[model samples]
Target: MRIALAQTEPLWEAKQENFRRAERFLKEAKEQQAELILFPEMSMTGFSMHPEKIGETEEEPETLNYFAKKAVEYGLYIGMGYVEYREPKSYNRYAIISPKGGVLTDYRKIHPFTFGTESVHYTGGDALGFCKIGDWTVSPFICYDLRFPEIFQLASPQVELIVVPANWPEDRVEHFKTLLKARAIENQCYIAGINRVGHARTSVYSGDSMIVDPLGRELAHGGREEELLVADLDLEMVWKYRAAFPAKIDRKPELYRKLADGMQI
Candidate 1:
């Protein structure tokens, strides 16, 4: 499958303007023959801490509807991130829309960026999200979830590809790249890390979006520029690499239980 990453520079808290920009990028991806395309975290809102300004109610999600509409219109699978409003707080959400205009799944962000006060404003998700697109089993995660290897390991057994949409800052750009490669190599699955570029209210993003194979080789990478990185991924590579190396088959789950029990290192 061919995937396109929209390494965008979102207009701060401007949903409509960002939507217009996204539409233009979608058209460009279509011309490149991309089957699926992903956008950065808080795609249209630029990671606003105040949920009231940009988050939409779950009962009537305008951004999700727009993604579905675009998916149907372009005949492309769309993976997008947005803020979902609930009572008392909101959640960072990732929605995958099929080409047929139906939503495949909505994954709430399991880990909120506590350092940025995100956890205080948003509710964390309780479970992992799994879905299928074409011939691949996919799992979607938000920005901070990239730092937790346990979550990635939990999904590794079934997921062929993991998608991380982030608003990671420019100062920590190297950590963003290094972690993405580490996750892909350790889990033996394809990983697509899509991040935003330009300035938000609190920080600047450098847009180090990339698609890394199971062997941690980058298939496509975007620099600091606001653009799309399109690359073809073979679904067979995930299974082929796993079968040849079979690294995951040697895991000792029972022994690792001590880590979860809060045992001293």
Candidate 2:
């Protein structure tokens, strides 16, 4: 499958301007013949702490509706992030929209960025999110979830491709790149990390977006500028690599369970 990573520069809390910018990238991705396109976290609103100001409910999903329309217009699957409001609680959510103009699945960020005060504004999710795109089993995760490998490990056995949408800051971009490759190598699956560029209220994003193969090789990489990166992924490569390595088969889940239970090794 051909995938496009939209490395964008979201205007702070300005959904209309960001939607225009996103549409431009969507057109380019369509022209490139990409089957799926992934955008940065909070693609319409740069990382903002004021969920009360920007959050929308499932009943009133303005941002989700816009992307769903775009997905239908572009004739491709679209993955993007937004703030979800559920009464008094809010969530940092990622939604996958099918070409048929329907949402496949929406994943709430399991690990909110406590360091950035995101937890203060949003509630963490308890469930994993998965969707099927063509012949591939795909999973979606938000930014801080990338730091916690256990969630990725749990999803790895069932997913061939894992997509992470992030507003990861430029200061720790090296960590972002390293973690994406590491997750791909460890899980023997394709990993796509889509990030944003330009300055937000709190920090700057350098946009080190990347697409890594099962063997930790980069298929596509984006620089500091805003751009659309396209790459063709082969699910056969993931199956073949996992078969050759047999790493997942060697996992000692019983021991890990014991550790999780707080038993001495």
Candidate 3:
């Protein structure tokens, strides 16, 4: 499958301007013949603490409607992030829209960025999400969830590709790149990390977006700019690599469970 990573620069609290920018990228991705396109976290609004101001409820769902329309218009499967409001609580959410304008998956950020006080404004998700695109099973995760390898490990056995939509800052850009490759290598699956660029209210992003293969090879990289990085992923490579290495088959789940619960090995 051919995938496009959209490294965008969203204007703070300005959904309209960001929508225009996103549409431009969507057109380009379509022209490039990409089957799927992934956008940065909070694609319409930059990372903002005020969820009440930018959050969209299911009843309202402005952001969701916009992307679904674009998914149909461009004839491409779209993955993007937004803030979801559920009564008193809000969630940082990643959603996948099918080419026919149907919602494929809605994955909330399982690990909120406590260091940035994101937990104060949003609720963490309790479950992992997966969707099927063509012959590939895909899993979607948000930014901070990339640091928690356990979640990725849980999804690895079932998925051939994992996608992370992030507003990861430039200060720790190296960590972002390293973790993407690490997850791909450890799981023997394709990993796509889509990030934003430009300055936001509290931090700056350099858009070090990357797509890594099962062998930890960097297939595509979007360096410090707003652009679309495209790459073709082969599912056969993932199965072949895992079959040869047999690393997942060697895991001692019972021992790991005991260790996680602080029991004697």
State each model's CA lDDT, in order.
0.92, 0.93, 0.93
- Model 3: how far residue 198 lies from native, Å: 0.5
lDDT of 2 by residue, 91-190 (tens): 9999999999999999999998989988888889999999999999999999999999999999999999999999999899999999999999988999
Model 1 regions more than 4 Å off: 262-265
Candidate 3 accuracy as lDDT: 0.93
lDDT by residue for model 1 over 229-264, one digit each (tens)?
Answer: 998888898888999999988998777996678786
lDDT of 2 at 186: 88
Expressed as tens digits, the lDDT of each residue in 5-97 for candidate 3 is 999999998988888878889999999999999998988998888899999988988888999999998899999999997656699999999
| Ten-residue region with minimum lDDT total, candidate 3 | 80-89
Instruction: Score residue 149 of candidate 1 by CA lDDT.
Output: 94
